[model samples]
Target: MLKDLLQTNASFEEELLEEINSLGKIVDFKSNDILIDLNEQIKGMPLLINGAIKILREDYNEGELLLYFLEKGDVCAMTMACCLGKKQSKIRAIAETDGQLIMIPISKMDEWLAKYPSWRKFVFESYNNRLDEMLFAIDNLAFNDMNQRVKNYLLDVATINKGRKIIKTHQEIANELNTSRVVISRILKALENDNILKLHRNEITIL
Candidate 1:
């Protein structure tokens, strides 16, 4: 897996990759597993080799807001931030699918930053990408209506799954969108009425 990942990700120099392989350990997670929770101390940075992880933020009212996903070949900028600043994680990370990752120790973060130009570039790029995703989420919450948001969410799911068929329940969508199940059901019914989609027991087929 490391060899294949290295073929595409040129950010890790051969020497750095050797160091990483020696220091880091391979870890696996099952779907829906909570990898990290709010205010938890981050021990290492997870370099995702396959599968997906969802990043979420919780409100004071116990509501959860979906942030963005870290998929194959992606790194969690929040984890990197916590590792660098020696702080706790402000968001939660949950495995979206069974996957594996290479967990690099926090101690190596600074050494690589100073020693490897490629590593530094990769970190900055990851940060910028995450910032953009957050901004997009903020824009949707602040500006878009519920209907539009739901549609956008479906589109995103379709893209992630690489298909138009979204296999999820209305309640699941509600939880991710931080809304009531009743509201989500109503919106989905409206979409069905408009012939925009076909809703089944727990699946939605986009038209």
Candidate 2:
């Protein structure tokens, strides 16, 4: 279900899948695999077939910040950096789970762009959409308080799971929101006391 949402559209059926299967190799990665490093030259595109991956930047002193997460059927948006001919990536990608990706050469993608303009447009839109998401995250961090930020993060995750709640550790939630597990625990306790949410072993349910 989540996978379908990531791959949404007819172009995957009409163009992407067949073309990918024809030329590229499907590569597998274990959890924590570094798909690309900061300052590395832009390669080609990777079509994620399974599992999840995160793209973020690690500053020498400022620490790490998440940029995005690409799950099953989600194409790597960094490929668009390559499309735009960017020299180096500002973000690095790491596998959040063991996964497989269809690797396509930039040269081949250029050929496809020339052959299928509509497919190219779809790919471009995917990148732009990702850019929008990044901007939103930045806005949240800049304007929202830590409590509101954490609350909003949980709400977003719940909405993503269709309001069923998220089954993840406090540390995981903290990592996603770029905060401390202790902080998250305190916040959760406050919310629980207010009868607003319930916490299980590692999950949270909105009440």
Candidate 3:
């Protein structure tokens, strides 16, 4: 099963896949589980298998906000840098949905890069993709209004979860968008009245 998941990346050769199978372990996670935290010693990188993981950027003054997300066949881009540089984690990772991910030790990452051309290419491409996403997020934060941001956030959530039903609390939405729960509630209600969504206690059904 682990090898199968690794093969999904296609950039991994059979030899590298076997190495990963031997070196990594798959772990199950529940929704809201913290896989990595700010300032923590970097240990291993997680390869998402079957669910969504939200990566958050921490700010002492402004609080945490969603940086991006890791979906199936994705790895946290920052983790690669932290692993290679021997730096502590600057971002926090939380499981947005229950799923399994393969944990590859940081020790093996350098070796893999040196030994496997496919691995090197994969890592570099991941960096490029992540940078693009970060830029898009920054653009959204800079020019988009709160209402538009909230709507975009919901659309992203719906897409990531692969469903129209978004099962998240107002506070959770607020944190993802870096706003107060009261603000999120107000925006959500307005959206609901506008026939954009149907709001339940802790869920929003997109229409």
Better of 1 and 2 by lDDT: 1
lDDT value, candidate 3, whole model: 0.88
Better of 1 and 2 by TM-score: 1
Candidate 3 regions exceeding 4 Å error are: none
CA lDDT of every candidate: 0.88, 0.73, 0.88
Which pairs of residues collide in model 1?
A: none
Q: Which regions of candidate 2 are displaced past 4 Å?
A: 1-17, 28-34, 40-42, 83-86, 96-99, 158-167
lDDT string for model 1 (1-207, tens) is: 466753435457888888987998989999889998999999999888887788999998998988988878788888899999999999999987788888999999999999999889888888998999999999999999999999988988777767889888888899889999999999999999999999999999999
TM-score: model 2 vs. ground truth: 0.75
Q: Which runs of model 1 end up more than 4 angstroms from their true locations?
A: 6-9
Q: Write the per-residue lDDT of candidate 3 for residues 1-207, one digit (tens) a residue.
A: 566665456467779888888888889999989999889998898888889999999777858889898888888789989988989999999998999988899899989989999888888888988999999899999999999989888999899999999999999899888889999999999999999999998999999
What is candidate 3's TM-score against the reference?
0.96
User: Which pairs in model 2 have colliding backbones?
Assistant: none
- What C-alpha lDDT, on a 0 to 100 scale, does residue 123 get in candidate 2? 77
Provide the RMSD of all predictions against the true structure, rounded to 1 decimal: 1.5, 4.0, 1.2
